[model samples]
Target: MRRTLDEFNDRRWIDKDGYQYVATRLGEAIASGIEDLIERVETERKLRSVWQWLPDAISAFPFETWSDLTITVAEPDAPYRPVGRFESLLRETTTVRFLRPEVALMDLCFDLLYQLIAEGVEMRLIDRPECHRYFLSTYPNRSSEMIRQDHFTILEHDNLPSYGTGLLDDCVTISCYERDSGTVHALIDTDAPAVREWAESLYETHRADARRVELQKSAESVPHD
Candidate 1:
């Protein structure tokens, strides 16, 4: 006896568990592909020079989560020209201008992570100092609304001093103070091989700068007595 179309489409075949099972299978396939892609990327070049790997390592998870991914690089040579009311703060504080580059990089990273999570991406790893020690609130309804209301702060930290709403995207904001001399040497996208090359270029540039700074400091520190 042949089964009817209704039987084929019955609850037995279309139950929640069945749907989960199919999703699980597809997720696994996607995860495997991502892993393979990462592996090939790592193998083709030296992984040590890739800065984006720091964030990518944290994002790699067992599930298929990420969709739209973007990597932004700050123009290192550009002078910090404060926008709007930020101009006053830039004039008042010495550290703020110096740290603008670092702040911009952190802001970009946080914004991307927040957007991904809002779109239903589960975070696996985030190396930012702020997110390292704590797990931010993940309540969808509250978090989603909060993100929509305050996404601008991520873009402009000069206006918003702190995340007042408990629903703030914690991935970008660091609770502890960082002492890296206020410079973002590089930004990377692990998914793209070209980004790795860019990271290498930055690494070289910074290495040269470090050597020059050390020599100058050494010269200045010589016993003047």
Candidate 2:
């Protein structure tokens, strides 16, 4: 304890008066800075596993919004936590827009998705060609049915980030996937307007560059025996 106090004194962070040491202004400032740094580090550690799968645009989000961000991570006992969160979002939304790189997130939600479409929810999706192909093969009847709906639209982008983005009603979500397995590992969502605006701009940029998919054309592109 003596050596630690001496080190603090040497750094001018503390002053000794008649054997009683008190923290100086510099000490308080340093302590506050260290507290913030530790908090940021902890947040990073929590996101480390899925960090690489998050959208690069997330870095531009205001730092203050990080605390307000809601993170739902999948757990061993509840492996479908993130998916359940997404489904709940789906059930309540009147509008849905997404940039999807993989189909895993939506694969299990096909029934709900189709029901939403039938209920006249406006939905637009920008996804990779391979993802569309896979979905068509996996759910031929439902895929065909949904695409024919006026309320649903599909656009194909050859390249997309590993992570997925969604603008569901007023909420914005970033879905992080496992690196090798391609299953959703976590979801980071926020209702912050600034974050939602950023997501909207990103979605528009990708949508503008993507090509609309024609149902017959897409189905024909898939190989058959």
Candidate 3:
């Protein structure tokens, strides 16, 4: 300890300010460092919860106790697209509020529709206008024709956020934007009451102003080419 102090002094690390720093609140500083270390360890453990390093991998609320849920994403794409396990969550769920930007029509048209419809679950799709012509050029077969407003509404994308949000009944999922790789979307799924309420409020507030989609009117009947 004496040698270490001598070395610190020699390196000018133990200056007058440094001495003051240790004298003033040395115990508190030590405690804070330990706390930070513990937090890092806990964070590392949570990150390893899932095989994939998603942003929202931890959930405070026990999944077994929750009922129906909701999900939201800042941009158009949903992280759930790559998550096949997400389908299991939808099986028993009745109503799901999918608040997001324009999604790939193929992703929602058949598989999602079939799962939700088969379960007789109410799946609300809230997004801006998706260019049907754009889908036609890249992908064939217009599956978006299957989206019926009878089950839900299509709200115009308004006040989009930078981060992704998901409200799963009691739990919530959040992710930050990664400009480098879209696949490496970080997730932070939690069941904190405050988070759930906040997410729900954001959805309800804009939902009032969202444009209600009339499926028949939104699309023009075109002969199969």
Q: Which candidate number maximizes TM-score?
A: 2
TM-score of each: 0.22, 0.76, 0.53
lDDT of 3 by residue, 33-104 (tens): 888778656655544433243323224433431222233223356555423334444454566675552333
Please, what is the whole-model Cα lDDT of each candidate in the order they appear? 0.30, 0.84, 0.48
By summed lDDT, which 10 consecutive residues of candidate 3 come out lowest? Answer: 65-74
lDDT of model 1 at residue 113? 46
For candidate 1, list the clashing residue pairs, or say none: 58-125
lDDT of 2 by residue, 45-134 (tens): 766766666676666565667656778999999999998898988898999999983687888788898899999999999998888878
Q: How does residue 169 of candidate 1 score in lDDT?
A: 22
Question: What RMSD does model 3 have?
Answer: 10.9
Q: Cα lDDT of model 1 overall?
A: 0.30
Output the lDDT of residue 125, model 2. Answer: 92
Among these predictions, the greatest lDDT belongs to: 2
Report the Cα RMSD per candidate.
19.5, 5.2, 10.9
Q: Which stretches of candidate 2 lie over 4 Å from their true place?
A: 1-49, 217-225
Question: How would you encode candidate 1's per-residue C-alpha lDDT over 1-225 as one tens digit per residue?
Answer: 125324533523322354342224545565588887886565434323333333443245222212222223233354232121122222232121111223333343444445544555422221232322111222333333423432211111222211111111211211212235443333322233333333334333433332111122322333332
